[model samples]
Target: MEHLKTFLLKRFRIKDLGDLKYFLGIEFSRSKKGIFMSQRKYALDILQDSGLLGACLDNFPMEQNLKLTPTDGALLHDPTKYRRLVGRLIYLTVTRPDIAYSVRTLSEFMHQPRKPHWDTALRILKYVKGTPGQGLLFPASNNLALKAFCDSDWGGCRATRRSVTGYCVFLGNALISWKSKKQTNVSRSSAEAEYRAMANTCLELTWLRYILQDLKVLQTVPVPLFCDNQAALYIAANPVFHERTKHIEIDCHIVREKLQAGMISPSYVPTRFQLADVFTKALGKDQFVTLRDKLGLHDIHSPT
Candidate 1:
């Protein structure tokens, strides 16, 4: 960057900021204890502007077992407003991953959202209203093992029948990356979908592990990749395959090779302790709160 800057802006005045405190719409605060990222002020402003600052909040971001379908009967008269609102919420996920899945799911119906979809978006806003200060926290830790949890909602989409792939990566206890996207291809079985999800997560995990190694944080001890499906775990552990999983894409099998070579170890975790469950589906209030607390987030009031 210095070399390029010298070439292009040779005579331009520039101030050298030693460290990055904030960038790209995220505010970063570092202290001796830990690093914290919050959009508290921005979230509050958005809530007030959306007329949800005083609304009754729901326990969960979205209702469980709710399947959204195409709005065939009587589409919304003004979907542009809903689309714009959801778009802003999508950007808010930079500091607020708690609403990632809900925002992503709501963003899917941007074209012709109905009243139900709009209400779901409003419900998420209401939930965010009550918890505007929620954000990611990174504690100072020497243990930098790149742990990842990958899961998929098998045939979760009601209209397209496409599964949802969700994953979250942790640098020790700090969550650095997460995603909730609809699968591009139709999967035949749940195991196949999960295998693909793990494969995608492996791509990210491998890249992050490389970057961390470059920064000399931790030597890549076989990254512990957790999944809840036994069949998918077996598929990653063993190279052989039966008729059920043969049709899965070859790219998805790369994680198997990584496992065999000791780059990563696929482990089975029960759904109760699965943190990735929050990203893949709409969870109940108890489960959501449990996982949120486990993510190292707390109410940081100063000497209350």
Candidate 2:
């Protein structure tokens, strides 16, 4: 531990507060309820610095039915500044999944951020202002059932028309792993898009299973992956190659093989219970809050 601290000190300005009460952007508080993570202070500083503290905070980060396209406008006259802002926001994802999907969306345009993109980012800053203390809580629990939720937005990206795949892995009620990523390949149909997303989610689940085995927490029960697409779930259960599925890469078949071997099971879940929905699409304010809370996230500034 001493050597690790020396390495960090030498690389950056050293301000050893003795113990790590906070690191990066997350505020750490330990109690009988287990470790509660929040970023209230960091979120407030970002809002004030971005001059969005006084702006009206919208319940959601982006407006409904909003679309983004490549613009020929001058890409953020100062590219470095835009990059810096993105860097900070990405770090905040450690404790702020509320901004995860939005941050990942803005990151795609980092190569060439236009005025509209910057305005959208500022809007997110304002939204953060309204709920600066919101963060995830890892309550103490022994029932570590490895359940997961996965979903995808069919051709959500306007530029490449590629789909966005998202999944969140939970240990009991605490969200342990989550991702919001754009698929590398484009799908011709919604089912195809969902299949690809499931493949990716399966791969993550497989890795987590192996990781748990290494940690000596291996369970006999198969991991359950809750997906909203019934078609995709059925495809995984059977190996028959349909006309549409044949076009998919051979590597994607790994998911189907894993399912047949009983490593994981893909079950259909209703859209209302899909917690991964927050990572795949921009939702209404109420919907976002509901899913966020389900992920075990709460506002630390609020009285429990």
Q: In each prediction, how many residue pairs overlap at the backbone (N, C-alpha, C within less than 3 A)?
A: 0, 0
lDDT of 2 by residue, 93-152 (tens): 888887788889889888888877787788788778778888887886658778888899
State TM-scores per candidate: 0.90, 0.89
Runs of candidate 2 with Cα error greater than 4 angstroms are: 1-20, 72-75, 249-252
lDDT of 1: 0.82
Best by TM-score: 1
Model 1: per-residue lDDT, tens digit, 1-304?
A: 8787677566777766756666765667777868788777777777888887778878678888777777644578988889889988988888777889999899888878988898888889888877777788888753777889989989998788889999999887888999989999888889888888999998998888778878977645788899999988878777777777767848546887787778888899998888888888888889988877776564442235
Error of 1 at 57 (Å): 2.0
- Candidate lDDT (C-alpha), each: 0.82, 0.82
Candidate 2 lDDT score at position 156: 92
lDDT for position 76 in model 2:
79
